[model samples]
Target: MSKKNRQIVLASRPQGWVQESNFRLVETDVPALKDGEVLVKNIYLSLDPYMRGRMNATKSYASSVEIGQVMVGGTVGKVEASKNPQFREGDAVLGYFGWQEYGISDGKGLQKLPESKDIPLSTYLGVLGMPGLTAWVGLIEICQPKPGETVVVSAASGAVGSVVGQLAKAHDCCVVGIAGGPQKCNYIVQELGFDQAVDHRAGNLQEDLEKATPNGIDIDFENVGGEVMDTILGRLNTFARIALCGMVSQYNETQPAQFRNFGAMIASRVKMQGFLVGDYQHLWPQAQEELTSLLQAGKLKYRESIAHGVENAPKAFIGMLKGENFGKQLVKLSEE
Candidate 1:
């Protein structure tokens, strides 16, 4: 591999919302593929909210990316060269290939994708991959919604939230989604079959939530932690289950914000649990199979907010943090 590879490296730890200066774009020689290794040219990169946590040098469920290291992320890439018999040139695979144009892997953590021209390769970074899997495990395993139950999801129009709401509807549950604006809320209820949607940006969130979830929430898929969480927590039914997937609202906070209504959890008997998708890796194959089937049958629908160039990734990520993205936030590096 004689070509040079360009990557976004962590230049500094963010004190709050990340700025472009925190990242440095650098060019370096592409490393050669050694024995049992493959050279992958990244086509698409996933820009998830969780990557914000990794940018900070703090202890968490996952290790933080060191300053000067390439910002870590999931990537879908095509093999450029391979020494491993299981992989060859032109084969597309998904792996933790970071924020780079190319990567060298030994194929240990790579998953070979089927050559299905019917589906867009970009879907692998969204509906058919991590976001989809997270939604599946959180809904089926954590929330365990039953027929006629009310299931509410925050960030309801996002990649994971959209899937969760659809899956809950498939299970005969009444799903309510909470998103940022009237447009996103409409997409959730009208396009995704959610029973209703509440705009968190509305002036009366608590009242809006009460109106939307008249029967009360039985399962709350927690995505944003802040005022929306406070309002939803107040409306939880007895024996409610909460799947704490993310807190994008609080991700950039320097200190933990106070939630005065958490006491409601006691009276509601709410069981709140936080989960990292990596902990449920064993079930990914099952999730992919089921989700893929849903997609093929036209039962599952997804949206992507794609930034066309790697050079624009920083702006896209910043936009996502500010609720600008309507679905899975992604950066497209190339058409390969």
Candidate 2:
């Protein structure tokens, strides 16, 4: 193990578009592992839309990252040194380790990565990790899709949205995916088995959605909340359910836009609920089993856009906010 650690720290808050100046890469001495603590070398770092909100000092579902602190993130890493009885040196684990080459943990909030011949280590950060868990909780617990029901999902080619669309199909629902470009739209329909897909970037977004879903939408797994949410809200059926997992479109807005049809919730009797994955942590084991089975059976599909090297993490994160990532955006910090 080395005597130093390198990390990306939050340099400042952004008003709209975050730039390179907002982050500063610095090196410092690695803290000695105390009793019951472990030192981990990060292998992969997850770049999520939620991190955008944390960059600002504001009230949100989670705490904001303070200036000069390591940018918060989930990491997959190998234990380099351990005084903890439960974790051994070289064991792979997953936890909220922030943006750094190495992290020191006291064993709390750490989970050992399970050995699976069919799954890659990266899956623990994508389809089999937080993104997958978010989709599972939103669709199964919030939306509760039924066979033959009409389902709509925004950002359908993304990590969470991709899983939501496929899971809806597994439940026999007619799934329609909304994405930004022709390539992603094609991937959703042709590769992921979505019944229909609409390119939200098209000039006639409302028209395309109406055509894709002839019948009213029954379950909406919303990820991008902007005009896409508005279009879907208009097509929602009576008693429709909306799982508000994320609002990637509004995350960068200085002042979030107000929904024009906010009053429609009363008329349609729709159930729109926002949720955090941590709220349903108790069901993780059950979700893991179900999602794993689906993956093993070739029913579940996922995509990943990875950037090599730690210095590229910020660029990859900004790209994800602009919808440039095809799937989960991850940064590979090192091979070990």
Give the least accurate 10-residue stretch of model 2, judged by summed lDDT.
Answer: 254-263
Candidate 2 has a TM-score of 0.97
- Tens-place lDDT per residue, model 1, 1-336, is 479898989899888888988888899998766899999999999999998998877787789999999988999989989999999899999988888889898889998888787788888888888999999999998888899999999999998999999989889999999999999998998888899988988888988899988998899998899878888888989999999999999999878867878987899888999998889988888888988988898878989998987777878888998899999999988887
Segments in model 1 whose C-alpha atoms lie over 4 Å from true places: none
Q: Residue 109 of model 1: what lDDT? A: 91
> How many collisions between residues are there in candidate 2?
0
Q: lDDT per model, in order?
A: 0.90, 0.90
Pairs in steric clash, model 1: none
Backbone-clash count (model 1): 0
lDDT (tens digit, per residue) of candidate 2 on 1-336:
648788899999998888888998899999878899999999999998889999988898788999999999999999999999999999999988888889899999998997677988888998889999999999999988899999999999999999999988888999999999999999999999999999988889989999999998999999989888988888888899999988888887768677776666878899999999999999898988889999999988888899997778888888899999999999998895
